[model samples]
Every structure is written in C-alpha cells, then in structure tokens.
Target: MSPVTYADIEAASQRLAGVANRTPVITSRTVNELTKAQVFFKCENFQRTGSFKFRGAYNALAQLSDRQKQQGVLTYSSGNHAQAIALSGKLLGIATTIVMPQDAPAVKLAATRGYGAQVILYDRATTTREKLAQQLASDRQLTIIPPYDHPQIIAGQGTAAKELLEEVPQLDLLLVCCGGGGLLSGCAIATKSQPNQTNSPSHHPRVIGVEPEQADDAKRSFYTKKLQTIHNPDTIADGARTPSLGKYTFPLVLHYVDDMLTVSEAAILRTMFFLWERLKIVVEPTGALAASALLEGLITIPDTKIGIIISGGNVDLQQISQLLK
Candidate 1:
C-alpha cells in the first residue's frame, strides 16, 4: 500500500478544518479565452504563510506527540516550507528551529523569523541544509519534520488538490508545480484516485508535474524511473530548485502522475508577470511553472477543463526590481 492514500487526505482535511485555508478555485476569462479551454487556477498564493506549504506543515505539527511537542521541532527549507513550519509551530505553541539557505528570498526569510522561529542561515555551497538540520535535531533533541517526505506532510498537502477537484469538476488535465514532489505527488494521488466525476473516457485527469528546465531532476527521474539530483540551478524559480524527489514522494509520483514537463526561465517570468498584470494575482516564478507550460504552448489540449495549481505568491520585490533593471 502507498504510504499515503486518498482516505488519509480526507482525514487530514477534517483535522485541518478551521486551520488550513480552502484557498480559491479561480477562473480567468482572459486565460480561458487565450487557451481556448476552461482553466481553473487553484490559487494557493492566498494560503496561510502565502503558500500551500502551510497545509502540510500545520497538519504534521498538529500530530506531534505530547512529548515531541514539548521538545520542539527542526526543519530545513529554502523558503515556503520554512515559513510554513515557523507559522505552524507558532500556532501550535511548539518551538521551531529552521535551517535555511543564506540566499533564500529576503521576504521569506523575514517572514519565517516573524513567526517566532529561530532561523539559522547556512551557505549552500559550504554545507547541505539536510546535514545541518540533522545535527541540530540531534543536539537539540528536537523532532525533525522534513519539508515534504513524511506521510503526514504528504497527506496534508493532498488536501489542496482535494479541495480544488471538489470545486472544479471533470478536469481533463491537472498541472502542478514540482519541487520535492510533496505537492505534486500528494495532489496526484488525490486526483488520480478520484472516481470519474464526468462521463469522460479516462478514469481521472492526467496529472502532470511542471518543473523549471534548470532543475529538471524530477523530469529526468520520471522518465528514467531513477532518482536524480541537481545542484544550485540558476533560475528565477527558487521554490522549484529542490535537488530531487523524496523517497516517499518519488514512488508516489511515479505511480500516480501521468507525466512531467519542464519550462524555461523566460516562460516562468513571462507567466508570472502576465498573471500579475492580467489576472491581478501575485505569483512567484515557482507559482507560475505549471501555468507557463500551458500558456507557452508546451502542451495543447483544447476544449478541456484544465486545473492549474498556483503554488505560492511569496516573492522578493527587491529581487524583482533588480531583475527589471
């Protein structure tokens, strides 16, 4: 059996009730007209901590044992997950220590600390965040809640897709941004396992994970059926720069996802700005990955109800201004 199931997601939904935001299933007439398809955007940018990572973080932290809660928790993340863990810990009254990259977005870095978590910045070239987290976890006797690997995290993240599917019926395709595959795999499980809500020929929507071309490990892993890795990729999508899929998420993604796709840095930025100006949604580059694929004509499935997950809205305005320079 899979480590996480649709039932687990459903249960997580109950646990997260009144905790995690249902987010929004938003439709853009401009987007639909441009694509010539029914496009529903699952806007997780409006989620607590400004990202869907809050769902998994809160769900995982909420289930900690009484002793574990007292002892505290530790984690490593680039940005979104860091903020998620920090905010969740604050709400749960659990102490949190986060090891983050020195180069993580300033906005995210400030927000993580703003939630009352102690932030330890590390040089990505000098040491791996994983090793730092492990050492700190052991020294502090703190439980480790990985950003995307645990069953509870996966189950929690699946709730986003469950809500999206519930709001928008009969999606022919589902595009999700892929980092370590927590969101992608979790969403895929919720989507593929769903019974056909329409009289369509397929059992479920075709779940496709979108990644930056610079960080194509997930794409390579999907096709080769082997775990892959990437170093610090030079891309604007900081959120999708994860080295590879997690142990739990890899298998889940391979089983549940139909395919994986990659988009360029240019496409990501273009889509991000387009959403900002046209759709009036503040999307970071990572948030634009899935939409970029569709908008850039990477895939053309016409006259279908397609669901695209906007993973986050957290962006460093300074960095964006610098890019504009």
Candidate 2:
C-alpha cells in the first residue's frame, strides 16, 4: 500500500482548520519535575467528541462524493471512533451506521446513538465487526468508512501531530498510543515529513507507539517486522485492544515509527489516576497508554523534550470510580 504523504497531512490540516479543535498542548510542572523531562501533552481529550478520532472521521466524511454522502456511511468501533463517525455524520447530514461490540461501554454507546446514528451491537467474540459492517454497507449501498485503514482517515489523523509539531517544533521524541497504528503512523508521517524552522538537518523527532501489554499487537509487529494479531485482549485500555494494524497503517508504522512499547495494566491504571489527580484531567485508560509508558520508565530516554498524544477522555464513570477505589 502506498504511504500517506506529507502533502496528504497538509491537506488534512487545511480541511480540519475550523472543523476540528486545535486541542491545547498542556504542560504540568509537577509532571515535568517528576520525569525530569519537558513534557508537552497534546490533549485530544479536549477535542470534539472528546477524542482525536473526530479529525479523521470528519475529514473522511467531508470528502465523500455527493452520491456517496446521499448513500451515507458505515463503520465499526468500540467507542471513540463510533462516536466520532456518528457526530461527524450528524454534522455533515449523512446517515451513519455503526457496528459496535455488544459489551462496548454504555456511555459511548449512548453517546453514539445520541449523535443520531443507527447502532448495531454484535458479540465481539462471535462476530467479526468488519465483515458485518461490510455486508451491511454492501446491502444498503452505504460507504464503508473504516475506523483506521484508509489513507484519508490516516491523513486526517495526522493533523493532530501536524498541529503539535507546528506549535512545538523542537520536540526530541513523540509518543503516541497505538491501537491499529492509525494515530501512530499518521503522527509519525506528520512529524518526520516536515523540517522544523531550525536550520539543523536533524530537526525531526523520533516517534514511538505505546500499547497495553495485554494488547501489544503493534509492539509485536514492530519487533517481528511483520503484522501480528491478538484476539479479545482483556484490558482496561479498551480502545487499544485492536486485533491488528491495517495495511495502510502498518506500512506507515514500519517505515516511519521509531519504536513500539507496552505497559502493564497496573501502569495504565496508575497513570490514569495520576493524570486525573496531578494533571487534573480525565484521561481514559487508552488515552493514558503513552503516559503510562513514560511514567513507568518503559522508555529510558532522558532530559529531552517529549510530546505525548493523549488520545481520548471517554471513560465510564462507574468504572473510573471502581478503579479509583
């Protein structure tokens, strides 16, 4: 598969200018002091639909042909992407059908439905959501907007890193939470493709992907130099529990990403609580994946300016209360 180009990311940035939120790059003095690193948090939790997925979903939906838009769109996601597509479709006046896991968080399911999309729930263990969505799209003449495989989606997701790099041009490293590698690969492209304002030739920062240890498909793929799959990983980071990377995203990750790391469940919970208590943010488990790796000392790089992509803040309140207790 051809990689998503720098030009694509530039176009995506332009497309998302007023549509997607230019989420703030937050900094915490306590966090900086604890890690001894200048940490810039690209807080996508503040984004539309409470996740960076809005950038990609809106971008993809906006680019649909009139006829395709008339036919509407279909996709499958656990939570964030589902809400993203639902809200994007609602905004674009396109009908959306989302096939979500039956056990998906009730908050996300309600949010998706509240955005005026048809929700179809299937058992994650017994049903292949992609195949079900494909069949539905085929039967209904709906355009299948994949959660993370398409070039348009990848480019759209790249806008986050584009905005980040534009704001903080001198980052030493960028760590992204990886599910199907869309955000990781997209951010890698955005970061590596552009030269900073500085005249130095080595202005590009290293990009790393962080995943839950129970759902380490990207980590395994990075190390094995091949795509890998896992089935139904039981983890608190539900958004990062994807089975494998897609074709478009896998190649971009292989080519542009520097490393992939996994963090334990304990680390994930700890980091989530830390962000909430210290950073005063309600970062979901998946959103805290990269920070978990950093706080847990999974990556040993020192004294450098680090940029972390806080993927989302869509957590179930009941779960949060239980976990906090």
Cα TM-score per model:
0.98, 0.97
RMSD of each: 1.3, 1.4
User: Whole-model lDDT for model 1 versus the true structure?
Assistant: 0.92
Q: How would you encode candidate 1's per-residue C-alpha lDDT over 1-325 as one tens digit per residue? A: 8899989898889999998888988899999988999999999999999999999999999999999999999999989999999999999999999999999999999999999999999998989888889999999999999999899999999998899988886788999999999999999988977654654547589999999999999999999999999987678999887888999999999999999999998889899999999989999999999999999999888899999999999999999999888
Worst 10 residues of 2 by lDDT: 194-203
Give one clash count per candidate, in the order shown.
0, 0
lDDT of each: 0.92, 0.91
Give the per-residue lDDT digits (tens) of candidate 2, residues 1-325: 3568989888888988888899999999988888899999999999999999999999899999999999999999999999999999999999999999988988899999999999999998899888899899999999999989888899999999999988988899999999998888899988888755455536679899999999988888888988999988888998987899998888889999988889999999999989999989989999999998889988767689999999999999887778768
